[model samples]
Target: MGRHSRKGAEAIRPDAAAADPAGRPDVPRPSGGRRRRQGPVPPADGYTPFQDAPQVRGGHPEQREPGGGWGTGPQPRHETTGGQQRSYAYGSAPGAPDQDAAREQAVARQVSAQQAAQHAADGRTARQPAADPGAMPGPRREFVDAFDADPPTPVGTPEARSGAGAAGPPVEPEEAPDGEPAERREAKGGKGRTFTGIAAAAVTTVLAVVVAGQVAEDSAGRGAVARAAGVDRDGSEGASRSDARPTPEHAVTRAPEVKPLSYGEKMAQPYPIAADLKATGKFEAVPGLAKAPGKGQKYRYRIDVEKGLSLDAGLFAEAVQKTLNDDRSWAHNGAMTFERISSGSPDFVITLASPGTTGEWCAKSGLDTTIDNVSCDSAATDRVMINAYRWAQGSATFGPKLLLPYRQMLINHEVGHRLGYNHVSCRTPGALAPVMQQQTKSLDIDGIKCKPNPWVHPGS
Candidate 1:
């Protein structure tokens, strides 16, 4: 048995040696009947070796000796572990460049360039010089020439180029020497001056038009006044006829003959009273005659009575001659004289006719006689047609107390028409009625009553 056990032990020894693959001679092996636990091989110096001693944990790789031992020394940095090297930057790890940081740097460079351009445009000096001398030139003649040769592209609008975008400060326009924006001042002053000129021109035109209208109105008014005053608009007297009369060759040499009579003798009553006169529609010339005793132009006249009337034509002729030769007659003041003509065409004819004939003659003469019985002087026929009814019976307006004066007024009034006199009224109440007044009708005019008058020249 002892021999068999020794041979078995030898065989186990050979198998153990074969299992030791490291071929370490000093290493101890397990001798129990079980197999050895699997483990790292020990060194021949009897020391255990550390595995992957220089390794990174939460931060940088731990410091270690060159022979893979723990030590307290600065460690060498690497871009990558057992791989391609990569560049590193601040706040970034190795193996790849910091794309986000590089992008930020590019944006910052663009912003700085924009700031420098803005400073130059605003006529200010930049604080910092350009980082790259070749990339950007300094402010010099050559740089200015180059810039001028290749001008920058123009912006679409002034607002966009002014840097007033959503993230930039607003730019302001330059001002003129007049303390206002150049463009704003020009717009305001130019428009204001133009408007002022237009307004002034309009006012001047209006004033001229008003003045012209007033001048025309004044001219028309003057013409109307001239016509109303019985004067020609051209400033000349409108005489009824030219003063041309055929006179005797001895008229200048001959002394006027006159027969003067007292007032009582002039007013003497004649035969065949007016009340006894018949109403006649026809007239006959008086036989009596007279000559003016004044040295001036002489006016010839004649008197006639209705043929069927009982009035004496000679007596009526005498009364007319006496009245015309009075100092208060139209011939007063040496302006003219009167002479009675018994025959031929006299300058004026004074006739006595009935009311019907008086109206007929008045109508034919274009005188208004329908309203009341009146005497009229026919300028065209040179006839003074005295109404016989008014002559013989007198007017109801003038009672018997004023019958004589009323007769004188009637003669003067009718004869005044032959002298180019127009109808007039008393200027005031109780005043003398003008000789041209129709006193045979009434002494009242336009709410004013006047006293009776008989002479052409009342003051005389």
Candidate 2:
């Protein structure tokens, strides 16, 4: 029996040696091929069985007996550490303390250096880098530093920098022998100042353009107002403020006598009698009238009286003309005609009369006069050819009734005939008498005076 037991132990010893080269005490040898129970085992020398065991993934113990009395001896060699088991790389050992301690000392040195740098920077002015993080170095940073150190002064100020000033571009500051900061030179290079120059030029151009446009607009407005007001008779001066002008109301207040025609006034008023009669727009009459040809194209008075009149050749003829033109109704109705005609010598022909002669003539003819009666055609002609002996205005029996108004009426009536207006029967009973009515034979019992034909407008 002793011999068989010895042979069996020898066979197991090789197997155990192969399975656990370190002879780990946690594993126990079974009694037979039937296997030993798997369990926690008490170790000799108080060494913990699991103190450095291969780690179980879940760090828990599997159910088993202390002595290896189990189904499988140490589990298959291919088996992985279960949740209850722990493991280690087959031959690796713990690192030496000396190497680890040396690494810790190096880390402490790095930390101390960083803290010292931060403390040194805490009191000084922070340096402003021209380049932010990841910026390139050289001229870009130098220029930025120069600009920060010196800024341009305000323009037009006495404290302003020169056109070529200290803020221009990079200039190295002078240094002391010991490397201390020395006084800086005025920055001189205009190079790399292109951006500033372009910006300044653009601003100047924009301002100049705006100013020029304002000036042009102001000048144009003033010119237009001056033309509209026309050349001042008194030759008044105007205000010179750039941003303001005399309003229309202000300009008008200064000159009451010189009435400026408004657009509305001009539009509402009628056209003048003759556009050129008064070059200066003044309408006063002149003396020393001249003789005119008989052509009706011009304002030449042509009249022919029947022979045998008692009136003075000139005075009577003049009176006849003056009376007819005075009546407003006659003038408005265009009772006078300016037709052209050839001559026959008789009384008088007034020429080159002003444009308002029709009105002037009416006023003149109303004057009282003494003259013999004459058989004259009652009419106002552009030209007057009267017979001194034929008419005999005052000498006749019924001649006294032919007052200035009546004579004027007669003249206007005849002129109406020449103007292509025919005599017609009166439309209204006891209405005013028309200048065209025949009043030579009967007295006017109805108190009728000249009235116009409502259908036609009147004018010279």
Candidate 3:
């Protein structure tokens, strides 16, 4: 039995030497191809099993089984070394270190710190904290202080640098004379203010030219307006006459020759009177003269009839007085006043005469009465003559229905002539003829037809 046991021990020795390159006599050998349970063994001097070593990653020691293998060892406990507490995980070796991994980690950390410093200098990020807390922050703080103290440079411009190996004090950039930004001057090609001033001056000049043109046009317009309002006395266009003129003669001694007229010829006629009227060719004044009721220039007038006239003088005078005193008359609104005077030398005379006598009297006043039976307000004779022929026979232009209104119009027309009004034509067709229009001659004149109107104020 002793010899057999010695041979079995000697036979397992080679297997154990083959399993472990380093000679270890404490390792139990397996019997019948099964592993054996053994008691915990102390590490050899300067050597430890791979399963008992510590593991490290990124400078921090990790709690892991050594060599990634499981072990049933005594639980580790806290220990104090160099006054610092250290903890070891279960199944870790007590005296083994991975020097190559630690050295490689140290080299990687150094390369990372150098890259971080370079990034900080290039302004990519803020400076990183040192791996060792006790390391001084002097160089980083100094760089930050210098950067904060420097004056800010304008964007899009290079920062001003100091000399080769020395850092100088920060300098403030000079301002432009106009207090404008350097970038703004560069953007506008250095002509911003000059261009603005030129544009403003151009706008002012344009406004001045427009204003001058308006003033010139207004001056010319005023001159034209003034000229258009002026009129002359000889029935011709002329300039304004603000000066007074001499009084006209009241009568004329010589009369122009009369051109004979045939019957049925159209003559501009006067107020109509009865056919059986008689005349004596001498004047007799209308009686019962009184001041007319109005508020304007007073004009005393006399109504005269020929001595041989068969007409009722009292009736004629009454009709004339009523017509002139009407509300719509030319004498209304205080424009003028008229009264009949039997004794005094009147302002003018209204005479009812025969056709032959009317021609002689109108000719003496420089009117062309030879054209036949027409009335006239002659400035030379100061007389408003009503032809008896037209008084008996109304004008061919007016129908019998308009005879009475025509008589009133005749009275207003001759009176208007004496009031310094010249003849005017109708302005609009179908409108009332103005008092100054020669309505008795023809209501349709200059291609404008008008209705007969006896009163000057048609609305009134």
Q: Pick the candidate with the highest TM-score.
A: 1
Once fitted onto the true fold, the runs of candidate 1 whose alpha carbons sit more than 4 angstroms away are 1-280, 368-370
lDDT string, candidate 3, 1-460, tens digits:
0001223343333346656778654354333432343333333243333443332335333343222221211223233322222333343333333122332333354345444444444452245454466432233334443432313432221112112112321111122334554234333422333344345544655777677789989988876765676643344667445336544577445687886643222122233555444455788788887678887788888988877665557766766776777778877777877788887788889887876677778888788754746788767896799876665566666665556666777788888788888988888999988888876678898889988787888797
Residue lDDT tens for model 2, 305-348: 32222223344445444433443433444434232222543233
lDDT on C-alpha atoms for all candidate structures? 0.57, 0.34, 0.57
Q: What is the TM-score of each candidate against the true structure?
A: 0.40, 0.22, 0.39
Off by over 4 Å in 3: 1-279
Ranking by TM-score: 1, 3, 2
* Weakest 10 consecutive residues of candidate 1 by summed lDDT: 1-10
User: What is the C-alpha local distance difference test score of candidate 2?
Assistant: 0.34
Name the TM-score of candidate 2.
0.22
RMSD of 3: 29.6
Q: Model 3: how far is 37 from its true place, Å?
A: 99
Backbone clash pairs for candidate 3 read 52-93, 273-391, 278-308, 278-309, 278-310, 279-308, 279-309, 280-308
